[model samples]
Target chain A: MIEIKDLQKNFGDTKALKGVNLTVPDGELFAYLGPNGAGKSTTIRILTGLTKISKGRARLGGYDIEKEPRAAKRQFGVVHQHVNLDPELTVFENLDIHGQLFGMSKAARRARIKELLDYIELTGRAATLIKQLSGGLKRRVTIARALLHEPGIIFLDEPTVGLDAAIRRRIWALIKKIQLRGTTVFLTTHYIEEAEFLADRVAFLDKGRIIALDTPANLMAMAGAWAIDQFKDSGMQTHYFKDRKQAAAFQTDDSFTLRRVNLEDAFLSLTGKKVQP
Target chain B: MINECLAIYRREMLILKRRLIRQMAGQAVSPLLYLVTFGYAMGDKIRFDGISYLDFLLPGLVAMSSMTRSFAIATDINVARFYWHIFDEFQAAPISNVSYVAGEVLAGMTRALMGIIIILGLGLLFGVHLAYGPMFWLPILLNSFLFASLAVALAMLVKNHADQSLLVNFVITPMAFLGGTFFPIARLPGWLQSILKLLPLTHASKAIRQAALGKPVNLHSLALLAALGAVIFLIALGCVNRARD
Candidate 1:
């Protein structure tokens, strides 16, 4: 339900994004992956109407962000990389305030906060100051804050950074539950496994360009079997393929040698193992 | 617009009220020190436009309290929020930018007004007095809000703690000193006096002291300060919205 056309942003002499474009269908879990400073946050910021796109237009749910910022923004829920809770407030109050800003009534806000609190498993510390909470709890509060309004599209920027494995898995499950409920999620993450597991379709962004865009498995199939075998270097042989029929060959192998193409391999193949911003 | 602003105001009020004693006590130091420095050391020797230094300095001291109080809030609370990324919540929220600016302006005004009140209270202990009545609050509130808005604008633009302190010295100190806070601009030569009249606080002080000394109300001075204040407030809101955008 979102379309971006040639989004470009410039900060003085630095060109952050150059003619970047993409789309996300309704209820699609679209992952935007890029190295740091590759304009991932800039694109998200523009989509939210927080920053001006120097040379392009962006639309959310068919509404132009610049012309219909309020309406566009109303349909968006964002969880920035930073912990977006007021440190002075309690966990429940953070969600409540977030809901209230979108014009929710107190009774509704109260019920919603309680529901979200239970969703994130923070009911016990609902009364504690955000500053007093652990990092995982605060991140959960941020995710809960994003989901409070139940917008059609939820945007997460590096949502799991600094989170422990257990908490990260829990949050990933939370996101999966959200998608199951039919919310479109547009997310960016450095963790290849996250993109592989969560994103329905992934976009590899390099140097402000979409180098590759496909399902995780399809991209992996591009990594030939011989190379895959050589890379795996295992007693258990690795079988790979150029297409889906051949891709299933690994599954049928007696040695159980299998080729699984995730985002990390796709990323390495498209843009060598070198950094790009 | 006002309701969202009220939410921000209420949040700030919660912080201030929870630490009411501590907040009030911290504000007392600056004004009290200024009071003693001007009222005790120079009150006897200085005379300007037919008044002792303490008597002349009182109105200015009251205005300065508001000025510094507002600056102090932005410096301590608002600045820290930006650095810690606590401000990201507000940016991502549904609250209007104007409402956010108004809420923060209200916080600054509250602290500044408190400082002004503390100085006024201490004034009575000096056994020196000006006309004290409810009517006096009009000018006081006007000047306090005016300066507080300016402080909010500065907070949105100023780079760091160093720039913050520099503003207090370079901008506010000069405005207080040259704007007839302690002595009448009429005593200066015509060229200097004309330049002094351009200052917003000059009009702020004139309106304040006119009400304080129970003199006839000066509509011109009140209008000028109010107009300058309104412009700065609008510009400040615009700057904040731009920074956010």
Candidate 2:
């Protein structure tokens, strides 16, 4: 389980995270969504030991992040937003080093890495260097590296930022498989469909504060069941309705079309801004 | 802590081993050129305390190689920081800052040892042998340690590779030339010699040269090198902590 209370981050005179509070129970896939500069990366950095926490407390698996950093860090794995693997190293070497850093014995690392390779369906590509792999393949290997230590919780920051739709779906399936095995997964992404399709619950953060938090279905329901995008010279405006009949009733021309409301619509309805620039 | 240190060291060694051939060629070229050119230009013409200039030049070359090879770690660190983002992984890992610095420093010392070996081989080809005793090696290790720690400290402070290169040009390059490596510091003017003595490499070169000549080495120089190394090592730990912050 992950818990954070009254978290705040300040950079000189600028405030990045402002008195944020959140908790994620074990075995839950929680998605944190926000636009750029919403403190998503700062929160992950503080939790993962990459940055110092200015204020508040964070705990992982009941271990305090600031007081018991090593213990807390050992309880969770992180896949950063960027592909930080050593490009000069082979896939197996990358995972092997991660296991070593976590203090896994050689025999244990070998066994675990082999199992993860098969689990990620990259058993044959273990010997390939990271630089030689495609972007999607590299993302998969990055995920596999994170799981090598078998931590109870995993934090993934934008794991599939630049992949195609097909590749993104494949990664989503992998994520579901991971969550099914009862690991608490904390994820941050810009893809609304990704959160809608995979997240057990979603939190919307803007300007360093979470504006909304609930299940994707519940959040979308709050924005009504259906939405119509009205195109105009000013801009595209979306109108939400409680049902499809109400949404169709508001459409006057071919430029308007009705569809089910998504998490993005819920975010926009709550914050009056798009989730992506 | 030991396990974490070994993990980081193992990563560096693995990468070094992969490119060992190219790295070996790069390491061998510069010292070989120096040995041939300087040995021919002034081998028999001048003598320091009746020792042939080539013999004097050999130990100096070894000391310089140790310093340069150890300090070269900054470049690798900058590459990992700016391009591969490998340091980010380490920052997020369970490894402590001290362990990270220790691992990289050890790897730097290893590179220095490799270069020392290559220089010794070239010296042998030229029939220039020195007293390879503990007195020689103790100072070499201390020299390597000091420079490697400095490398790690600077590597963590610099923002990018270009900035790293600028530091090298301003810091390491000048020390390599004027730190009693290629010539005797005593030959310089009194004021200039005073300035050169401030460099760690000056003491290292003097100590190594004395040991190579089968003479009693200066304990003050060795002590100074060790003291400087410890101070720089602590600075490295501080820089790493700051970088993590």
Candidate 3:
């Protein structure tokens, strides 16, 4: 659904995206992950046509973003990191206005708003002003607003930040449902667990560059945090292997078990910082 | 493209209509304050061609309202950038660049018109005079739209809200004061009078005050303002497109 090649974006003396290249297939849930200022957000901005490229080419659904921006934009739904809803408008009105932006008719907008309200569980709060809703609810409405056009791809920039665990889980579940409908999901998240749970493929970025890219399980397995903790009658023994593959492939029988690692451990090993708890 | 612009226009008008009372209150109260303060409280002592200060000040107050409405529009462009992130949304959408610019300009124009319209209505209540014909609205409307466009352009160019406000206070306010808003430009020295002729609002004030005081329209002043407005609008657009780069 999306293709970017030799993407070089510079802001004055600072290079935000340095010769970056990425491709996201249709119906794939891809997470672009990195620490702060790793150019993850920059890459997303470029993909969504919010920023100009210093040099390179980007195509969405076969339409060039620079040459045919309108067509390219028509292919994706976008939800930015910041919640930018009109606090003065009702939840339904907010969605309705967005629908109208894309040329949706009043009746079509009404039916779509109702469907989105139900999907986001904001039906009762439909007539209430957005400022009256909680942060989680506001975020849901933003998601609903993005889907008003039913685009082929959804570009979500950190959609689950600052939410409680239950709300995060619910949002994640909703995202999974979006993925199940065969829409491409391109997201950038500071939340390690979010990338782990929702991403079919994760790209590790650092300093405007992608250092590593693979599935979450693959990256974790590739992080190579190998350990051997042995139990004896007198004392317990803990041993660290040179690499994860060694520990992962080490012999295990009924008496002992080989452990499995997740994206957090992989992130810590690769980036040398603890993932956000 | 024009259709998209009309959509934006309608959306803005709807917001103004939905908050009609609030909009009226906001626009009406400020000009009324100026009318009361300058027309009645400080109507004595100051003279222009042996005329009372109220007569001199009322026209100034009218021009001030127009300029201030332009400022208001410029400052509020942050609505899209900071509040709704509508600019970001537009950057990604299938909307044309003209539509994006038109949406903001139309909103600003409407606000400027509101300020001008209210000032016209209140001018009569305060015993302040204006051109009687409906044709007087021509220059007033054009002046408001051009200045409003300039303001929206400034909004797009300024890096932050604080910077935008500083420009309004330091540049816009000074221009209004020096452009014969509060007094007669004829009192100035020959060199300064020549410089004042270059200012858009100088010509704007010249055109508006003449039409109000029942003098023949100054074609040269009208031409100068229109040309100046065209140049400023083009420059503003250049600033906006450059910022995008």
Give the DockQ (2 decimals) of all models: 0.41, 0.80, 0.45
In the range A1-277, model 2's lDDT, one tens digit per residue, is 9999999999888899998899999999999999989999999999998888899999999999889988998999889898999988999999999999999999999999999999999988889998999999999998998888999999999988999999999999999999999999999988888899999999999999998999999999999999999999998888999988878789888999889899999999899998988
Question: Residue B65 lDDT in model 1?
Answer: 64
| Candidate of highest TM-score | 2
> Quick one: RMSD of model 3?
4.3
Q: Candidate 1 residues B126-234, lDDT tens each?
A: 7669975654566666666677787777777865667778888888778767887767888899999888888777776777777777777688876776687788788
C-alpha positional error of residue A255 in candidate 2 after TM-score superposition, expressed in Å: 1.6
Q: What lDDT is obtained when candidate 3 is compared to the true structure? A: 0.77
How far residue B53's Cα lies from its native spot in candidate 1, in Å, is 4.2
Model 3 agreement with the true structure over A244-263: per-residue lDDT tens digits:
67775664644344555566
- Candidate-wise lDDT, in order: 0.75, 0.92, 0.77
Question: When only chain A is evaluated, what TM-score does every model earn?
Answer: 0.86, 0.98, 0.87
Give lDDT: candidate 3, residue A20. 78
lDDT of 2 at A73: 86
Best by DockQ: 2
Candidate number with the higher DockQ (2 or 3) = 2
| Candidate that beats the other on TM-score, 1 or 2, i.e. the better one | 2
Off by over 4 Å in 2: none
Candidate 3 ranges with C-alpha deviation above 4 Å: A224-259, A275-277, B14-23, B44-52
